[model samples]
Target: MPLNCGIVGLPNVGKSTIFNALTSAKAQAANYPFCTIDPNTGIVTVPDERLSKISALIVPKSLVPTTMEFIDIAGLVEGASKGEGLGNQFLGHIRATDAICHVVRCFDDPEVVHVAGAINPLHDIDIINTELLLADLETVEKRSQRVEKLARNTQDAKIKTEASAVAKLKATLEAGKPARAADLTDDERTASRELFLITAKPQLYVANVDEAGLANGNAYTEAVEKRAAEENSQVVRICGALEAEIAQLDPPERTEFLESVGLHEPGLDRLIHSAYRLLDLITYFTAGVQEVRAWTIRRGTKAPGAAGVIHSDFERGFIKADCYACEDLFKYGSEQAVKEKGLLRSEGKDYTVKDGDILFFKFNV
Candidate 1:
């Protein structure tokens, strides 16, 4: 399954501008609202400095980086749950994503119109979140009604479990809390996934600030950070207009620009890393003389399941994995040195993968 984050926000909040910067794609960005009706998706590489370090040390002939997807969905409006302004289509696109990247307008530019008629980050957040909450509320209500009836009639444990999950979801949504904040068991969570609740997905906020707001956050960004902290989520501040300009530069020019700007890397890099973490993703590496590649896996994924990402046959004939931490290689300067130091180990199927692991899978098939 492709792990994707849907970019959502009110109109003219720089969602498309950020998307275009992240992917270097020509997604239409206009001063007006709803310029993007259909979602524009781009495959974005998950930047990890470790990947390059590994390639440099191993001196591979080819290096491949793992990637994720980003979808720029249509702008949302108030009463979106009630089918206002392409609401149904927008909600569908969001439901299809694995996570959400909410873009909040933190910059005040009188030229670009704000859909909510002013520059209030908190209000913008509320409008978008309220619509998603309302949509999820409807989904849970409908599911609860059906599942409750079926649970009363049938003796199936699965039906009973789903009914219980639906009840929890209904109560949470009615209380104005997101479905994700609802207390659900493992089985309940699995059951809830079938409903594709918009509020249930992991979310982070992107504060679209201007050039002045980049160095020290403006009041709008401070408000956003406070809200994100309350929800235990993170906020990444980016200057969308500036990032777009940086994206257009060549590699050498880009590096120079970043240095001159007193930044280690582009803001989009932080955004991508935050999104990857929000989705609970980790990267492992496979190194050889011919190629060094990075593979993405969910956090706490076991050896066999991770092997399956490479090929189905690998998992079917799974034996063990030769795993070593990439950090150990950085410390020791060679894989053979890692083995001598006993950092490398033969991991079994029960072994869980860790971030920055360099793995060599061994299977019969």
Candidate 2:
């Protein structure tokens, strides 16, 4: 999976608004549909409280936070799969992303026009989901025809495996299920990954609520929660307008603003943290008196793969790493204390990394 998420939803649902708040970039947010023609890509820093504590101790020359990309895609309307309202064009952009953040407008505003005529999250969700399903269905059916031809001529096991995989995908799509809904073996999954089907990507719902619903949530948000529960998806309720303003504040003022709202941190932090978890991403740290930095890796990443994310040379060296969990530092009060307590240890190439790990790599140039 790509280490990024794509923002998708109907037009005028504050998709661009939330995108701007998340990235701190001004993508045009207007009252009309299809304002975002091309997708806007932004890199957002992943916030970690542990990074702050590490920084306090290390006092590095500069601090660089780990980041994830978010792409703001154009709106999708009804009949999008059949080429309605720039449907195919937008769908192509979504397919390129690793995950999807579906923005639903839960706040009612007469000024900002609703493309669907009213605020109905379930209806809006159906419009986008149906289009994606249709697009994937078309792809599966087309591939199925070609695969059947190969299956007839070839006796090779690989060809037969692909043929069977495509047939299975076709059956699922025919039954109005997504390609992800189909069961496939490890080999079949490897073959299917080449297709990069949009419906196969994991998704989370983002309910953009008004200020009144930001804390406890309102009726529209309640409806979204119910629908998300049925789909086995997660929903995050936030006020995009409020977040935009908070993004512009200075650090001190930002803290005060959050306090006034009875929040210890911005909602965007929770959104970012949730997105990280939703992607099954984990963080590992490189710490020292010289520098302390956070790195992102997949949950099951081994030592070498995690090292490669920092630099290819680190992986090429293929040496051992001095590692300890960040919690050990917090618990024991310092690296020296942790070392004395026997919390620090050496890990080899096959070692699987854990979240909040503090690593010191020993390698020859």
User: What is each predicted model's overall lDDT from 0 to 1?
Assistant: 0.94, 0.88
For model 1, residues 322-365, the per-residue Cα lDDT tens digits are 99999999999999999999999999999999999999999997
lDDT of 2 by residue, 7-126 (tens): 999999999998999998989999999999999999999999899888886677767679899999999999999989888899999999988999999998899899979889889988
Range of the 10 consecutive residues with the lowest summed lDDT in candidate 1: 138-147
Q: Candidate 1 regions off by >4 Å? A: none
What TM-score fits each model?
0.98, 0.96
TM-score of 1: 0.98
Instruction: Report clash pairs, candidate 2.
Output: none
lDDT score, candidate 1: 0.94
Pairs clashing within candidate 1:
none
Candidate 2 wrong stretches, greater than 4 Å: none
Best by lDDT: 1
Q: Relative to the unseen true structure, what is the C-alpha lDDT of residue 38 in candidate 1, on a scale of 0 to 100?
A: 94
How many residue pairs clash per model? 0, 0
